[model samples]
Structure formats: structure tokens, C-alpha cells
Target: MSETLLQLRNVGKRFGDHVVLKDINLDIAKGEVVCVIGPSGSGKSTLLRCINFIAPPEEGEVIFEGRTWKRFHSAFNFIANRKYEAKLPTLRAEIGMVFQHFNVFPHMTAIENVVLGLTKVRGNTRNVAREIAERSLRQVGLGDKLDQYPEKLSGGQKQRVAIARALALNPKVMLFDEVTSALDPELVTGILDEMRRLASDGMTMVVVTHEMNFAFQVATRIVFMDAGRIVTIGTPEEIRNTTEPRARAFLSSILG
Candidate 1:
């Protein structure tokens, strides 16, 4: 069996008085594609953000690559926890993320956008960055659109560029938060196809998506969340044949 690449131990999150994620625990093995499915405002995105420390959990340990990063008790302690903060750069570099919105820089060409991280974060030379960026873009089937700016590309193309940008970082795991949600219906399949290709290549991925068909085919495990907690987690076959009342009702509503 593959090793656990990432884990959330009793993770919790809140916004003022509103609780979002509650005591969420999950384990993502190497090369495992775990899809998180839930209705709107179920904290799927928040969970991913916590993994990347974009939204640090108020109470929990984010164990990635065997290192445990914990939340500080007080706001002042949060910043004072330099030991944990010091690891953020390396952790962020090792875990790539793609959001629902294609956040490519508008002025930069697709190639330029992909090269930014290699040059800026990893500090690779511009020439070396371009070489790696070219390969990454090609991997996403965007070699011909290398010079195209975001404004010139379709919604699907823009998302591909985002994926390629993340790929260039050579992350250990990839987190995708509803990456196809903003695309047109026809464009959704293209993005999902690219994702399937990534999974085929043994890329460990954690995706939060609503497309049940894509989830059924791509996910090694399906996690159903509701009211700030995981309701059920099972294999695609088990999920499809579940008898649990809450799981059945939720699946019926979404898949029907």
C-alpha cells in the first residue's frame, strides 16, 4: 500500500461565530484520488484551504509528508509559532492547488504564467523556467497556446493553464476545489478529461467537486460531507450501493 501523503487530524475551522469545518479527519495515501462531494456551504473548499494553510484550522494537526503542523492557541502565538511558519513555504511548494476561478495573471501569456512560480518561488533561472514551463504546458495539451494571454483563451484553456502552472511546481499532492464549476457545460468535460489524465499518471489528488459522474470514475474514495462534518466515506461501489439514510438521501438529491 502507498504511504499517507497528507492527513487532517481533528481539523476545525470557523468564521467569527459561524463554524465551517468541524473535527474533520482524513487520510490521503500517495497516488490516491479522494473526491469530496457535498452541497453548497459544506466547507469543502475550506478544508482544502486549511491543508495549504490558506485558512489555517483553529484546532488540529495538518500532517503532510510525515511532518505535523499544528494550529497555535492564541492569535499572537499563531505568528510566534515560527517553527511551524517556517515550514509553510516548503509545504506550500509541495502541495499544489487549483481553484474554481482561473486565476492566471491577465497580462501574462500562458507560458509566462506557468513559468512565474518556477522563477519566483523556486528561483530557477528564466531559461530553465521556460524549459520546464513548456513541458508542463505540453503535458496539459496547451503547447500550441503557449503565447496566448488569458483574455484570448476559453474558460477551459485558462483552467488548463492553471493546472499546468501547478504541475510545474512538482508538488507531492494536488488539491482542486471545484475546478470545473465556472466553465460552460461543454467545457467541463475537457477539464475533467485533463484531471483523469493526471490520475492515470499516478498523481495524488484531493478534489472537491459536484460532478458525480466524474467523481464516480476518478475517485478511489468518495467523501460525503454535510453540516460541517463527514457523513460517510466509501468506495465508489459502496457509495453507489449505500443503505445509510443520510448518505442515500444526499446522493439521491445530487445524482437524480
Candidate 2:
């Protein structure tokens, strides 16, 4: 496998006339944990979406594990590009996403939720899926909650189940979009702790979060964004001690 797990060059996204991301460039290496931070509407989440092609970029290219996709001109000239359609599913399978809201099925047990993707998407047998689900749940500390439904699980536990669902696929990269934002303050650390464990186990992760503590502690690199562009990219210590005015102000506003 390539050491460079994912790369984006000059990626851009727009909604009608409004630009959500512009000239964004990023590289995520294997086993790296990168935390992205910025104020609302700063393109933090949009960058991750572009990485997974959930919302493909309008310009530039995305290269993942040696496969490449480029944006091109269309007859309508509307930022439309149609390339790599066949490989998209395979690309997406290697990159997993966990949303802020725990989007678990109301009727399914924790194990069942984790196994759905394995059986449905990956074509695994029920027995095989259950084994993977059980192991994944254990990884997230939800072993005891396997048979419990989402409604019976706490916010943190539900989020763990969601994480387990993603883990069952064994994605090469995990994208977490503010996974702790909707949880109760007390439950937030549980999810953060799970993330920390994953990082220690060498999972490559791109996390868009407001949890500065988690970012400071676990991130191999921190990316600061503003106005749809990355303003600063550094290690935790470099970011904390940055003298750049915009970076300083943003850090002070959040850290202090």
C-alpha cells in the first residue's frame, strides 16, 4: 500500500454562487490522525466530504491509495465532471464516515446495526457478519450492549455502536464529523476515549471537531481553516505556539 493514503490537490466546492471550499490541498498519510478546526462555515466538514467524494470537488483532483480522479469541464459548464464512476464504491469502502448524530436504526440491536453494512454491502454471511460485529463492538467497549437496541443505549454507547459499524468494514481511513457535539457533556469523553484508543492502534483518521482537548492530545497534525481555505497546518505544539495573527486569534478565542 502507498504511504500516502489520500491526497487532494486544488479541490474546490460550490453551492450555486456560494463557494464552500476553494483551492484546498491536503495529504493524509497512513496511520496519521489529523484534526481539522475552524469556525462555522469555514469548510472543515466540506473538506472531509470531498475526500470521500460524498460531495465531489468541482475542480482539481483526489488521489487515494494510488487511484486518481480529476475534475473536468462539462458541456453545461456547471462544475460537473464524470470520471471514475466505476471505482467510486471501492474508494468509498476504504473510507468510513461517522456523523455527529448517531444514525442508528431504531429497530435494530447494537450488533445488528454494526453487521448491516457487512452483510448487505460486503456480502458476508450472517454468521461471519456477527463475528465481525461482536469483535468491533468489543473494540469500542460496547460488548455488553450488543443485544441492546439503539433506544436503550446512552448517547455515548449509541455513538460507539455507530463507530463499531464503521470499524466492522475495517476502513483504511475514518472520517469523524463532530461525533461528540450532540452528546451530553458527561458522555462526550467516552467517545473521545474511544477515538484515542483507535489513534493509538494506528488508525488513520480525519476528524472535524471543536474538542480542542482531544485535538491537542491525539492529533499528529492540526489543520486550521478559515474562509474555505487552510490557514495553518502544524503539529500540536506548533499550532499552540503560532505567532501568526489569525491563527493566534482563533486559538485564543477557543483555548482561552
Candidate 3:
């Protein structure tokens, strides 16, 4: 059995008085692909952000690689607590994220974008980082587009480059926050195909997606969320055949 890579316990978050996540608990195993699905405003993306510390949780423990940590505001309230601050860089490095909008730098070439973090954050030398960057791009089938800037690429290509950037970090886990949502309908399939390939190759992933077909085909487990809470979780087949009323209703609305 795969080891557990991440564990969330009693995780809660709020924006002002509005609760975005309520006492959420989840475990992500190594090399497992868990896809999250829900209606809009269900807090799926916010949950992903919390995991990666883009939006720190107001309450709860997030355990990554056996280290339990909490994100808390400091007394000054302008920054995260000092104890947690030291761990942020290492934690962020191990978790790669691809956002809804392709956040690739427009000024950098595809390879440059991939190499930047490796050289700067990971402290790899330029030559070493460039080699890894090129290999990552090739892995995503963007080998020929290394010199192209984000503006010059198609939406699908840009997303692929974004994936390559994340892969270059060699993260233990990858987070996808509706990565294909910003693309054209025709462009969505290419990105989804790449993700399917990643899952097949045993990359651990947590995806917040509206693409049910992709979820059904690629996810080892599916989590259904509603109103900022998890309604149910099951294997894809179980989700498809769920008897729970809310699950059935949700599946009906989406599958129609």
C-alpha cells in the first residue's frame, strides 16, 4: 500500500465571518489521485489554496511528509507566525500547483519559466536547472516549444508549459485548481489528456475540477463537496452508483 503523503485534520478556514471550510479531514496517499467535485461556491479551490499556503487556514493541522504544522497569524497580524514561517518555503517546494488561469510569465520562454524556480528557489545551478527544465518540457510534450514565450503559445500549450513548470519542481504532490477552466472548449482536452497521463504514471494529485469525464477516468477516489463541506467520498464506480440522495442528485445534474 502507498504511504500517506498528506493528512488534514479538523481543517477550518473563514473569510471574515463567512466560513469557507468547516472541520474538513482528509488523507492523501502517496501516488494517489483524488479529484474534488462540487457546485460553485463550495470552497473546492479555497481548500486547495489552503493546502499550498496561498491562503492559510484559520484553524487545523496540515501534515505533510510526517510534519504537522499550522498556519497562524502573528501578533502583529501582518505576517504568518514565526515558527510556521520557517517551514513555508520547504512545504511550498514539495507541493506544486497549477492554477485556473495559466500563471506562466509572459516575458519568459517556456523553458525559462520552468527553470526559474529550480535555479532560484532550489538553488540549482543554471546549467543543471536548464537541463531539468528541458526534460520537464519534453515530458509534457512541449519539447519543441522551449523557446516560445507564453504569449506566442496556444492556450493548451500555455497550460502544458504551466504543468512543466510545476513538474520541474519535482513535487511530492501536485494541486490542480480547475486548470483547464480558462481554456477554450477545444483546448481543454489536451490539458486533461496530459493530466490523465500524469495520473497513470503514479503522480500524486489533488484536483478541483468540473470536468466529470476527466474525474471519472483518472481519479482513484472522488470527493464530493457542497456548501463548504464534504458530502461524500468514494471510488469512481461507487460515486457513479451512489445511493445517497445528495450524491445522486448531484450526479444527475452533472451527468445529464
Candidate 4:
């Protein structure tokens, strides 16, 4: 365990009349891996979105690195709204997120795809950005594919390129939203191994995953959510042995 790097305080979210997150409170420590699990529609993905203000929460506060942000509502004051929007790029950069899809540009080479953000948002010189991009691709075992386009790479390789793009930004925390769900079964291992290496290197990660074995083995803590609320939070052993009915049902359904 390390110092708390991100905090969600009494967070809640809704889409129309239906609630997606209910007073969700969580603390993510630096150098820790926290696996968020439960059935689909349990707000796992929404939770990640809220953390990075993708779809900001409807209620409560998010505190990252000591800066506090309240729920983002459309009806809020215009000045506050503009300020919120202004901070998003920097916020999102520190909180790198990868999605279920690779989302790489088909026309760009892997390195070029990674360099896009570095040059645009970060304002790095092209040569400096390229060097950083090259190192990041190499970090993800994709040094040889720097010139390859998304259409020319396998699903896993494309995912690696996406990951390299994130790493090039040097984010403080990484949010993985079902990153391996779309990959072929055989290709999944390579991505999982990359994540494992990140965990071993002490990168703080919040992962929404259905991979029970990886959750059990790698997580410093596990969060079990159900029907828009966190039903349990504990180390893998505590969660695995939880008596909470909703959590037990989820674990049995998935892990059995």
C-alpha cells in the first residue's frame, strides 16, 4: 500500500432516471493495483469514466493528487464549466485510459499514432516526441512495429500500440476499461502480461476486468459492485471469502 493518489467521495451518477453509481467512495493508492469486478451493468465502466471526468459524476467529489473537483453538471455556472473543460486535457493525460477497443488510427504508423498526442497536447518538438514514442513502443515490446500501421498488425499488437501511446504521455495512473475483452483468446495473454509487468513496476492501476484469476493474483484490493453500489472492498482473500450475498453471488457466477 502507498499514499492515496485518487479519491472518490460520495460519488453518484445517473443516465436519465436510472442511477448508475450510488454514493461510490474509493481510494486508490500509488503503486497499487485495484481490480474492480462484478457483473455487467454494475457501473464498473462508469466508475472509470467518472474518475477521469469523461462522463463526470452527477454528485460528489473527485480528489486526485490533492486537487478536488466536484460533479460536472450541465446547468452549472458557465465560468466554472469553462474552467473544468480547460483542465481536461491535463487531467486526462495524468490519468491515462485504454478502452475495450484499440482505437488506433488506421492511416498512421504506430509511432506516428503515439506521437500525435505528444506533439499536440504536450507540445513536444517532433524529434523529441518521436524519441519518446520510440522508447514507449519499445517498453511495450513493440519497438520493431514502430513503422507498422494498425491494419498491418494483429489485435494484440494494435492494443500494444495503444498502450505505447498512453505510456508516451508518462501518466501518473492508468485506467483500464476491459482492455482485453475484444482480443482473441490467444492474444489476451500478451496484453495481460504487459499489465502484469506494469503492476510489478509499481504503476498504480484501476482495472475493470472479468479475469478472476488475474484479479485474485495481482490486485492489492478488489472492489465488488452490484446494482450501482460497491458491495464489498477488500484484499483478494477477503473478497474471495466474503459473506456478502451480492458479492458472493457475483464471485460464484464468474469464478465457479
Candidate 3 displacement at residue 84 in angstroms: 2.9
Q: Each candidate's TM vs. the true structure?
A: 0.95, 0.92, 0.95, 0.96
lDDT of 1 at 108: 98
Residue by residue across 141-242, what tens digits does model 2's lDDT show? Answer: 888889998999889898999999998998999999999999999999889998998999999999999999999999999999999999999999999998
Candidate 2 residue pairs in backbone clash: none
Worst 10 residues of 2 by lDDT: 77-86
**Each model's C-alpha lDDT?**
0.92, 0.90, 0.92, 0.92
List, residue by residue over 121-172, the lDDT tens digit for candidate 3. Answer: 8999999999999999999889999999899998889999999999999999
Query: Residue 2 lDDT in model 2?
Result: 34
**What is the TM-score (0 to 1) of candidate 2?**
0.92
Better of 2 and 3 by lDDT: 3
- In model 1, pairs of residues that clash are none
RMSD of each: 1.6, 2.9, 1.5, 1.4
Error of 3 at 153 (Å): 1.1
Across 47-124, the per-residue lDDT of candidate 4 in tens digits comes to: 999999999898998999999987654685998878778887777888888889988989999999999999997899
Among all windows of 10 consecutive residues in model 1, the one with the lowest summed lDDT is 71-80
Error of 2 at 116 (Å): 1.3
How much is the lDDT of residue 9 in candidate 3?
89
